[model samples]
Target chain A: MSASSRRGVDVGALVEQARDGSPRAVARLVSMVEDASPALREVAATLAPHTGHAYVVGLTGSPGVGKSTSTNALVGAVRARGLRVGVLAVDPSSPFSGGALLGDRVRMQEHATDAGVFIRSMASRGHLGGLSWGTPQAIRVLDGAGCDVILVETVGVGQAEIEIASLADTTIVLLAPGMGDGIQAAKAGILEIADVFVVNKADRDGAQSTVRDLQGMLGLGGRYADDAHWRPPIVKTVAARNEGVDDVLAAIDAHRAWLEKTGGLRSRRRERAAREVEAIAVAALRARIGDLRGGVALDSLADQILDGKLDPYAAADALLAETSD
Target chain B: MSASSRRGVDVGALVEQARDGSPRAVARLVSMVEDASPALREVAATLAPHTGHAYVVGLTGSPGVGKSTSTNALVGAVRARGLRVGVLAVDPSSPFSGGALLGDRVRMQEHATDAGVFIRSMASRGHLGGLSWGTPQAIRVLDGAGCDVILVETVGVGQAEIEIASLADTTIVLLAPGMGDGIQAAKAGILEIADVFVVNKADRDGAQSTVRDLQGMLGLGGRYADDAHWRPPIVKTVAARNEGVDDVLAAIDAHRAWLEKTGGLRSRRRERAAREVEAIAVAALRARIGDLRGGVALDSLADQILDGKLDPYAAADALLAETSD
Candidate 1:
């Protein structure tokens, strides 16, 4: 709606401006992505060459685990090192703010006018495939826009949070005392995905105990055993007071160094690329199938299943056959 | 691994026993489903004749909004009315007890040995497509069993919970007074999926205001406005005390009745079937892609992208082509 947005900058211009680290251009580019505009493919084609440079880190924990505060602290530290930072919080907890944008913005208001930081809150709208559907593309936009670092955050409560693991190079599973026991987290499958553990709210009473619980659980796994070169480290932080925040960053830096040294970085990025592509292809196929619904073919398929003449698996096979054409 | 479980009971026998309202048979069948056993297709085929009688209901809200207590109360009320109830909690929290099953069982202990109730807590392991991957199949097993009503409860904090709405005939969104404002819920996109809203913990000070706020927000939504048949009714309850719980059931029943009268029930179920089938097909395709990874074709494509000789879209196209064969 602004005069200096998409209306002012054409598709190529927008991508170019964005790659030059213009926050407004970046915002406009992502908004286009969120809208699923026709020109998005154009943006992607344009952004293709410039991506794969930024390092993506995911911050996840259950709600009230101080993810926002930690993200704020991380941004400050990363910015102090003079790196442009991009924050994408895939929040599903707000109506007006979309992904708790208002709350996140208020929590991260210190970076409000900082030219070195670009933050966008993706509302959980058009949530296809358990993410903002356009998130990977938006990450490309930010990465293509020349951000040195991008932090992807999600509520670490459900299956959707796993998307961040696939997207990020380094995943920090932030925790607060009394959130839950270690078994709860392991069973939740967070243990497998976490590269670094941040015990946020370290001033809280159970912080040491929480750290111990996590350590004891980690010991039970072969996670850092034998073939593992880099074990996930738990860094405690009172994010509210900004204490031990630098230690957390140092842990991340260490993890990054380990990744590069072990050649795990390339594998991770390659897998991320492959996964992203597969998701897109599946989404495309889904769209094709979705378009077929309400038509006679799909309705009759539904009818046959409802009539018990066809089971769901057979019906799905038939649908897949239709798609291959 | 049990003596009389899958190792002993053949698929046909399992199906027969499950249909005879055998709790052990149902549990075994569901476990087989959770394992994604090769006999699953046979099981689904065999049980196809007996499903569709159970009226599925979904209860969801953010974690700790009293969903468990409310679900327990609803089960008690429904069972008192002579309906055999089955409960499935798709919990992503906790390591050992998926969906706080231990706590859930403790709360609903009175119904434990009733023989009419079958309770299952699905761990959010093998999280394929924002669900436990076993949920839809497990529902089929439960539906095929003799339960007259099945309740699906999920921690309504992430994208996966939306799948519940598609799977159930009616979705009840549970909220506590301090959960946040109407904007948060709306932003979370829970507004669209909820067929009914239950404000649990009504004794809290802001309880009335929560109801009022929800009512005001509902007024803004055109969800049922054009249909004019059933607007989502907000029911207040202190589920722990079991008061006002029946009203929630009544609201669900009313929604169910309206759905039946309008032919909406059939449409909803039909859509659910279609969606489930599509999800299965997509998951299968994803598995195919996964299998092909590290193979020559996928590696070359990945290399092409990394080398900047080909873009991700093109790589994805090449990958999707490989899956069809």
Candidate 2:
């Protein structure tokens, strides 16, 4: 290991502890990586070889839509089916405190002490698209440690939250009644990415109407053929009362089975692997360019461009020319 | 012009006609670009030199949320101040019909014959985000044609719609009462980018409460001293009655003044220019790479990686080596 890696912390040892089933060690590792400690890359390289086991499920929706309650109920349902489940609830980072509430952890206390369950709450930390750089790495650690199902709950909506859909095998979009305007507004982003739609708080007055409206809209712009068989399904749940959780689980199972039957799961996994490689490569290239000798030239160029002394195209050309030499 | 540019319709001539105040020519130019015609890129290049004249304003919210009504009223307010206006109402493309309702055009018919007012509808055409690739170029055409203010209404609430915020000098996010769930869900993306917030249909039951909730949320976030002068102002509007339209316009003016006074506008413009250059460079690189002599070999490697026959990292390395040689 390099000096920076050594002096930072022994993340590999913590990974080993986590693999051997130490919750505290896993928690510590997650925190270290989320904070982008220098040792994260080392830990990630160590853990990469053991990943690809878990079926990651992403749940997203507007706030106050019962995402937490639904997640907790889903965990209970999954446990009853004899599956080892792990939950990663991403919370909004407090811009002031730079900390997260981890409220989902508190809300799901029923499974907190269960040896079969592991729960972690992550803060967004100003990461664009609501994902920290360490999220995929943390998921790898959990997957390597033998979690069968990993549930990821986003802190917010739109493109950032939708990114979870790209990372997860199955993505569920939660909605509530009286969100007609919001749903219409979000049609361009969240609605496009949903693998399944769940209308939570189904006991509300406009529950049936909301479902009908969504169904009508889906019909008008459906991307899948009725015969395609893995089309996104709509489910209704009153998560607070734990109603309709089984139906949601059944829908997930059906989707998984379809993925396997159609040989889509393998293809999806391959796509994900390729994407991960590309993301990492791009990030590494940017970092290396930042660390080059005379790299401060780029910063100075930015200042010049900001001050209108240089056009952006001319500055980019100059930067590229300098790098080429 | 190249053979490919000549064989197709001359986009520059069309643009010149549009600039000479021909509404039919402007409409046709938008259509040609939106359809991704072969000569679109060349046309965009020609139009680029004429951009940076108009102040682009983006208004976005959920469908069925009175966005059209608000936009129509805002156009009147802007024109009443003796400024020529152009409105681009972007709608989601239907997966089945490959068409859009163009509903906003009909709703804003009051200005159809005003000569100074131009309105057009754009379809999303499967672009993942809300804004289409041709939007900026279309805005440039309108700018060169002497529109004092260009208003872009996004297709939906997705992150693509939020892209308009980055492109426009000012962005207004419209929310209605009972959209608390949507607000909570989309807060992470929309709130961060909003220059002005509008709680439309404020006569609704939950309007006051929702505004209060938003205020509380904004308070909990850290305050930047630089933003103090241009803090996003929330205004209530009843578009049907034309109430609060003046306040919204005044708020936009105030924000623009603050942006200029604080030097935020110049810095933001610089960042945008840089990003645009980066986007163009990346696109050019992708196109050039596809036309290289060893392009087939690179493509085959990419296929192998996608099929999982070879690891993505190894394939990337091989491609990079081949290209360098």
How does each model score on TM-score? 0.61, 0.54
lDDT of model 2, residue A275: 49
The sequence of per-residue lDDT tens digits that candidate 2 reaches over residues B1-325 is 8754468677677778877788998887777657656565555555655666688888887766688899989999999999989988766544321244345557888888888898887765553233434566567668867789999887445665567777788999888889663465345477777788888999999989878876765666653436454567889999988999999999999888888888877666655554443443333333334454234665565456444355444544454344333
Residue B206, candidate 2: Cα error in Å is 8.1
Candidate 2: regions farther than 4 A off: A1-325, B32-40, B62-65, B92-101, B125-128, B132-134, B155-163, B175-194, B197-227, B231-238, B241-247, B277-325
lDDT of 2: 0.69
lDDT of 2 by residue, A1-325 (tens): 7554459666667778878878887777777657666565666555655566689888988778888899999999999989888888776544322243346657988998988788887765553224634466567668766688999887555455667877778888888999773465356476667778898999998988888877776676756633354567889999989899999988888788877777767666655554444444434433434554234665665566445355444554555444334
What would you estimate as the lDDT of candidate 1? 0.80
Cα distance off (Å), candidate 2, residue B147: 2.0
